[model samples]
Target: MKRVLVGIKRVVDYNVRVRVKPDGSGIALDGVKMSINPFDEIALEEALRIKERGAADEVVVASVGNADCQQQLRTALAMGADRALLVDTASAGGAPGGDLGLEPLTLARVLLALVQREQPFMVILGKQAIDDDNSQTGPMLAALWDRPQATFASKIELAGEKAIVTREVDQGLETLEVGLPAVFTTDLRLNEPRYVKLPDIMKAKRKPLDTLSLSSLGVSSRARVKAVRFEPPPQRQKGIRVKDAAELAAALKQKGLV
Candidate 1:
């Protein structure tokens, strides 16, 4: 059976206001709202659409994080993923011990291990996660797997073992064809995800959700990059209303912006 693998991430919801820790350690997460990365949700929606069209037989969603991430996985199942895998790094000593809170490279390694095990025909992910916004995982996973990649994909069409992808580039759309077993990162223009009904939510609770230890995969979760600190962007200076064009010009001149 042809299988499609979709990578999901749990992140602070887009609506939530993120606050950097006072100690500059990281963002505060206590009792904050969390949701599946919006882009990943779009990727999963695309994967499910491909399956529905009979181009794929199964859609598997995978996430790497602590047990708290399973809630997002269940939500993916409710949305139509056939199965879920949670690569738990917390059991191996947590983030401080280099086993959790994975950086992009380590996360790519974990996804690589899953790819080898599942042997899916294709892998799909969001262009970037809202939390970190690194936008690096898809290309890194493609490099690790030695497969072609299409990033910022707005449209995907399967033709036999090949995929025709249209990507959103700064200069407009660029189309390309890649053989199966490739990686794709979705953009916002992709199809809208279906709302999970209450019945599906209940059914998802019974769907298979397998948990695996990062150690068991034999992949190193050691972070190659460390966050020294996180600081919010500087606030914009207040703007003043000008009485007329002359006043605006005078203000601009005073600020040396003209």
Candidate 2:
């Protein structure tokens, strides 16, 4: 069967205001609303569109995190994925999962395992997860899996055993054609994800959601890079108004800007 695997991430909802804990340990998540990463949502939407267009037969959404991430996976199912897979990291060395310690390389390895198991025609993921914004997983996974990758894809079209992708670059949009069984990382301009209907939400609860452990996937959840600390940006100083060029010059001189 032709399948498309789309990866989703549980992150603080884009609308929520993120806050750091008092101890500089990490972002405070007490009661904060969590949702699927926006870019990944777009990726899922693209996969669904492909299925709708008859280019793909199924869309499978996957995530790597704690059990709480099941909530986000269900949301993906509601968004029209045929099934959901959760790589349960909660049991990894007894450390808490989904608490910002997992690195991108580990994530790539996990995805690589899923790709081998599922044998999907394509794998889709967001260009970056909002929490860490590392933007490294997709490329790393492609390298590890020895597959062609198209990153920052603004548009995609499937033609037989190849996919034509339009990606945004510093200069402008560049188009590339990659053979089947490739990786794609979505960009903002990719279609807007559809809102889940109440009926779809009800049906999603009945859809299959399978959970696998990192050990089961043969990928360790150990962190290669440790976060030393989390510090919020320093507060901005109040701006001084300059009534005239002389005042501006004086203010610039006073602040050593000149």
Candidate 3:
């Protein structure tokens, strides 16, 4: 039985209230809620489906976040992961400076230890994280592991120690065949994610989630970049309503955005 691993992250859920600031960092207003990122959920779904199809034996979900993230991991387990692992970023007094703010390369470095230990047949993840919107981690991990990787995968197939991955190219869908021990970063069209039933949620409580520290992984990085100011975007102007078709056409023509 081969082992499949998927990367998951707890982030400000996409549907939550999002206030994009002048510099683009979203502001969390009072009582704003956070949840597992949507893209990651899509990846998790694909992994679960692959498992259900018996393409692989077990689905192991792992994440790097604060303690609150464990709930999200449990949610992953509920969704059908055989087990979970949380690389604790807060227990050891947080990421030295704050937020770990680690670049994709830095994260790949940190995760390599876990990856080496797990030695999964395949690694799956979302094309990009909703919060950071950086699509670099999965590819970075593949490079670190010296394995083949396909990104933005919309469709995927596995057989005879190989994977046929389909992704949306600039013009249309493009397919590529890669050998096993490959990596995939899935897009939204890959598969539909499942919701946790009460029984599954309860069952998740019994699934094991191993925890580890960054120091244990021996990860070090220079704070190459840091966000300084947070400012909200300018409020939008009130809409200018048009009554007639001609009026609408004329308005569109005036804006030259038709």
Candidate 4:
């Protein structure tokens, strides 16, 4: 049976206004709302579509984080993943990092272990996380696994053992064909994710969810990069309404913008 792996991440909801913590630590999350990263959601949706169409036999969803991430995994199950796996990095003893979050490189290492065990035909993940927007995990995972990858995938069609992926590039859309055992990072233009029905939510509660400690993977969680601090972007200056084109030209000349 062909299997596909989907990576899900819990992140601050895109609609929330993020703020840096006062202590120069990280972003504040005391009472902020959290959800599955939108891009990841799209990736999962594509995987489910493939399975439904009989192009794939099974879809597995995985996440790396503390126990709190189980909520997001359960959501993936509700959306139609056959099972879920959670790699608990928070409980690793003598881990190299102080933060609860795993860096992209560390995350790719964890995913590599999962890929070895599951032997999925393909792996799918969001192009970037809403919180960090690093957009590095997919490519890093592909490089680590020594497999082909297609990023920013706006469309995907699976053939016998190859995938035709349409990507959204800066200039325009570009399409490429990649063999099986590859990685794909989903973009915003992908299909919209389906909502979880109440019945499926109840069924998901009974689905298999396996949790493994990061130590078992034999991969170091030591972070290669560290976040020094979080800072919000500078606020934009207020705009003024000019009387007419002449006034606008005059103001532009005064500000040397012309």
Backbone collision count in every prediction?
A: 0, 0, 0, 0
Pick the winner on lDDT between candidates 2 and 4.
Answer: 2
**Decoy 3 TM-score against native:** 0.90
- Compose the digit string of candidate 2's lDDT tens values, residues 153-228: 9999888899999999999999999997999999999899999999999999999999999999998776657766
CA error at residue 51 for candidate 1, angstroms = 0.7
lDDT of 1 at 33: 95
Task: Give the local distance difference test score of model 1.
Answer: 0.91
State in Å the error of residue 89, model 4: 1.2
Tens-place lDDT per residue, model 1, 1-258, is: 899999999999999998888877778889999999999999999999999999899999999988999999999999999999999978767774221268888889899999999999989999999877889999999999999999999999989889999999999999999998899999999889889999999999999999999989997766557667678899999988999999999999999998
In candidate 3, residue 208 scores what lDDT? 98
Root-mean-square deviation per candidate: 2.1, 2.6, 2.6, 2.0
RMSD of 1: 2.1
TM-score per candidate:
0.93, 0.92, 0.90, 0.93
Residue 240's lDDT within candidate 2 is 72
Residues 1-258 of candidate 3: C-alpha lDDT, one tens digit per residue? 678888888777777766654554535544667777787888889888888898888998888867888989999999999999988877555544343256678778766777788888888888888876878998898898888999899999997889999997788999999998988998888888988899999999999999988778887654565665556657899999999999999999999989
Task: Candidate 1: count the clashes.
Answer: 0
Instruction: Quote the positional error of residue 28 for candidate 1 in Å.
Output: 1.2
Clashing pairs in 3: none
The better candidate by lDDT, 2 or 3, is 2
